[model samples]
Target: MNEEKNKGGMMSVIAALGANVLVAISKFIGFAISGSAAMLNESIHSIVDCGNEILLLVGNKQAAAKVSDKHPFGQARAKYFYSLVVAMMLFFAGGALGVMEATEKLFHPEHNVENTWLVMGILVFGLIVETVSLRVAIKEIKALNKDGLSLYRFLRESRHSEILIIFAEDSCAVLGLLIALGGTLLSHFTNNPF
Candidate 1:
């Protein structure tokens, strides 16, 4: 049963990772076409998410290694360490960069965002992809959760780090996409990057 649960969690992570990579690529293209700071920030966020997912997978693999003479209790702590690294990357690469970009746009406010429709389309598509990924993670979490707890409670108390991470990442991605769409639309009508 534990193994089955682990498999489900791994599948969720894989699904989110794949979706993030594709979304990152699309966001990059949109950024190139429209030169929108929001698109650029979102692209950076998706790229960071891709890296985070890879780190999680590596951490899980390392944690699963058998105990050795040098470390009798095994390397299960690797997962925690990697989770910390992922958090830092999300802060610096995603959150910090986003703030910096938005601040720059506010100061300059001279960007002419061409291809607005393209950026909007990409944002909508990203939202759909992120929603699907979130659904997959939620489904796996529900399957593993046998205590009949509420979704919020389960997320708060769950020990499955991979699924939790994916859920959080996908949730943020969806929110970011919506924000990007709003920013793009606002900039388009206002004719200012801010």
Candidate 2:
């Protein structure tokens, strides 16, 4: 069971790294081309995602270390602590900053944000990458549950904060992407910068 948990953690970390890299690149290119505050927000979000993935990788590595006499339960809980910090960072740094910038844009409606088809293309690519990453994470979780651990109970009581944090980050990423897409299209069609 422990081995399976370790494998799941490793898989999740790898998936996160891949997704963050792709999303970061796509958001950066979109921001460069369009100069949209929304895209800039997404770019910053992706940067945070990249950093979080690195932290998760570190946590996973540490958690997998062999247990010593002093700590028999091992370092698995460290991954959870690390993941919690990542979640807090995303909430404050990515989501809050985006909202503040968007509010400022609302106050100054004249600030133009150029739009191009390239941004749309990049967003579509990002969606695909994120979806793939999410699927991989799901698979890892399923594998971890093969030992008769009730799925719902496991999710409810999992002490690994990294799992929760990753889920939160991915959920936020997907929601933010959808909102960005809608806002970008609305702005392009109506020429309104909101």
The runs of at least 3 residues in candidate 2 whose Cα sits more than 4 Å from the true structure, single-residue gaps closed, are: 35-41, 68-74, 147-154
Off by over 4 Å in 1: 31-41, 189-193
TM-score of 2: 0.81
Q: Among all windows of ten consecutive residues in candidate 2, which has the lowest summed lDDT?
A: 108-117
lDDT of 2 at 107: 85
Q: In model 2, what is the error at residue 22, expressed in angstroms?
A: 1.3
What's the TM for model 1? 0.87
lDDT of each: 0.82, 0.72
Best candidate according to TM-score: 1
Name the 10 consecutive residues with the lowest summed lDDT in model 1. Answer: 1-10
**Model 2 global lDDT (CA atoms, 0 to 1):** 0.72
Candidate 1's residue-wise lDDT over 39-122, tens digit each?
787787778788899998898888778889988998877876887788788777777777887788678766667788897899
